[model samples]
Target: MMNSRNFLDLEEVRMEVFSGKISRAYCYVLVKQGKIKAIRVGRKILIPVNEAARLLAEGVN
Candidate 1:
């Protein structure tokens, strides 16, 4: 199982957390909006598992 300490890529977030309802562009927006905690590792954007869960539970609305 995934945990807070683990980091997930944007695609993983879309596939697993958001269920692909949101696009990569929106995911970038979410990171920019500061709704979710994330970091850039080279060309990839990664989010913490717990933060992703929090964002889902809270919703972007």
Candidate 2:
């Protein structure tokens, strides 16, 4: 099981990763496109911190 601390919500991703440049809708699109790996908990989308790091390392296209 993965700890909740290892995940980030779309808002955090936008703020921390993109510096608030991207919207949540765009993040959702990335999730739908498989560019960002996410797990759904109820209605909340949780993205793995490592995945965010990978995106940072690889650069989003």
Candidate 3:
């Protein structure tokens, strides 16, 4: 059900992707680092599927 257009919640990414070690603030850090893209909708930040893939790929390094 996940597509390139889908946006992931920051909290979900923190738990699922980073395994609870990364905080939401650090998610913003990734954005700042240009490792991912954050879409700000109101007060929440969302990660697109492609950007999430980029972050996951970064773990290989």
Each candidate's clash count: 0, 0, 0
Residues 1-50, candidate 1, lDDT per residue (tens digit)? 26545888888888888888988898899889887779999988998888
| TM-scores for candidates 1 onward, in order | 0.80, 0.84, 0.69
Model 2 gets an lDDT of: 0.83
What is the alpha-carbon lDDT of model 3 when measured against the actual structure?
0.73
Superposed on all Cα atoms, the candidates' RMSDs to the truth, in angstroms, are 2.0, 3.6, 2.8
| Best lDDT among the predictions, by candidate number | 2
The C-alpha stretches of model 2 lying farther than 4 A from their native spots are 1-4
What's the best-to-worst order under TM-score? 2, 1, 3
Q: For candidate 3, what is the TM-score?
A: 0.69
Q: At residue 53, what lDDT does model 1 achieve?
A: 80
Q: Candidate 3 lDDT, tens digit per residue, 1-61? A: 1554588887877776788797778777877776667788998888877666776767623
lDDT to native, each model: 0.81, 0.83, 0.73
User: Model 2: per-residue lDDT, tens digit, 1-61?
Assistant: 2255899888888788888898889889988898888899999999888988887788676
Stretches off by above 4 angstroms in model 1 are 1-5
